[model samples]
Target chain A: MVKSYVEYTFKNSLPPNATVLLAAPTLPIQAEGGIPGNKGIWAGILSEMTEFALLFGVYFIARAHFPQAFKEGPLRLSLFAGTFNTVLMISGSYFVANAVLAIRQNRPRASVRWLILVLIAACGYLLTKYFEFRWNVGQGITGKTGIFFTVYYYLTFTHMVHVLWGIMGLLWVIARTRMGAYTPAEHEGMEAFASYWHATDLIWLVIFPLLYLLR
Target chain B: MKAMTHKRTIGLLWLLLVALTLGGAFLGETAAPGLAVTVIVSLTMAFKGRMVIDHFMELKTANRTIRSLMRAYFYVVPLVTVLVYLFGDRLARLTTL
Candidate 1:
């Protein structure tokens, strides 16, 4: 017979104060040793990683060939927009992670609130990115401007598309949490959404430095 | 008690992330591009990536295979970033057809 509660374990590598609960499954229970969220989501995450890896390859190669352009490219861009978007991305990931934690503790209402906060942060990212793009155009920085701008535009635009999907996923998860579709025992969908959102955040963390900070 | 602790941990991680982001910005704006800047930025990138992977993604206690894959990506990419910065001319020559 399947147990009522899933039996999972978080590594004790974290500080003792930050040790995670012994059992918290975002999805329905699988075998004793399963990945977070679920196998399906892991597959998706891996594919996303592969896609970004190729893009990073492109970025590195471009930077290699146009070192001077890469160095000066960031100077012409707005650092304010990059920093704002980074903060929003980090905050959104934080809120979503907290939402998962809240649901794990059987606090669906708190989870919903956290999810809402994540949505707001995600929306802020979109707004900031939109304005940043407009500012780029105003500065005559388009893909055709040079190899550096071309690589920057494609990498960032691809990331923005992922954020768009994450927003739609956030809406679905928020609605489900409000409807009481999740519990401490079963909330795989929300967990999957969190994982996806975090992956997007991870990609941006890398992109921000390569494009804006590494100069 | 455990839940509260985890919440606080997440909050702390977020604070650290914000601080690092600001630090990176300061370095980028003020520091000239060179080995020192490249090293610091590369290390910062790796650290930030690991924090998100292990904490926010809750992969620390995850399956060995999945966790390792994610961790490896963070490690490899940042290292490569540094390498590219240090050896761009050689890399460019090698890749040029």
Candidate 2:
């Protein structure tokens, strides 16, 4: 049964917190590294630069012709909230990144703790996000941003959904970590979890700027 | 849970963010604001985002496959932005501009 296989692996997965996976043939001697990257971890950073240029260009063209809608919408935006969330998401990413590092350093207990805090921050972020949504909806702020606000919400909320999913995954990993399923050595599970978390962080890095900060 | 200053770093980032948030709002509220407001806000936000992705999301130490997946959003952003600006209104009758 699947249970037995899991049990065997769990029991013998190189000592739940071994700093190095010496016995495992598949595991590498070190964490994966890449080029210092001009664009950093943003995978589509380069490929989509032109696309943004076009989008903003379209906005300029449209704004020049029909300035009424776009002007009104951005004028009423809550930069306060945008900035707050930007900071929150950024800070949360740092905490979660440390969680991954804790595992690498062979500290499961510490790693789980860091992840738990990150999960809390995720909840907080969702709370602020939904609160803003509620306020916007209640105030009948629909179609306020026209194209600007419309796509802004569309993109940000979609990204937030991804963040929530990442948090859920982190929670599951935390539960597993508590159960002693992973160690520094045979921690493909932890590694995979961290990867997902980083991906979430990576997306937020770009979206926050484009949506809130960019003029 | 004490993994060598996790809490402290989170705290520091939060404090910096509060300061930045106030700065952004103050600047955003200014009349006849210069381009510096936009640049400051965006740069601060971008800086924060990188921190989040690198530290909280753990991408700073991630491998190639993970990093690639994370970076995919960079493309998604511009693609969606440009496509929506150029064609979103026609496709869905949703443009306000």
Pick by lDDT: which candidate is best?
1
- Candidate 2 lDDT, A60-102, residue by residue in tens: 4454345355446555566656666766665566666566666
Worst 10 residues of 1 chain A by lDDT: A1-10
What lDDT tens digits, residue by residue, belong to model 2 across residues B3-68?
445556555765775566566656656644334554455456556555554444445655566455
Instruction: Point to the candidate with the largest DockQ.
Output: 1
- lDDT of model 2 at position A144: 51
Kindly list the per-residue Cα lDDT of model 1 for residues A15-98, writing each as its tens digit.
565544334534422224456677898898899999999999999999999999999999998888999899999999999998
| Residue ranges of candidate 1 with Cα displaced over 4 Å | A1-33
| Fnat by candidate, in order | 0.73, 0.39
Per-model tally of clashing residue pairs: 3, 13
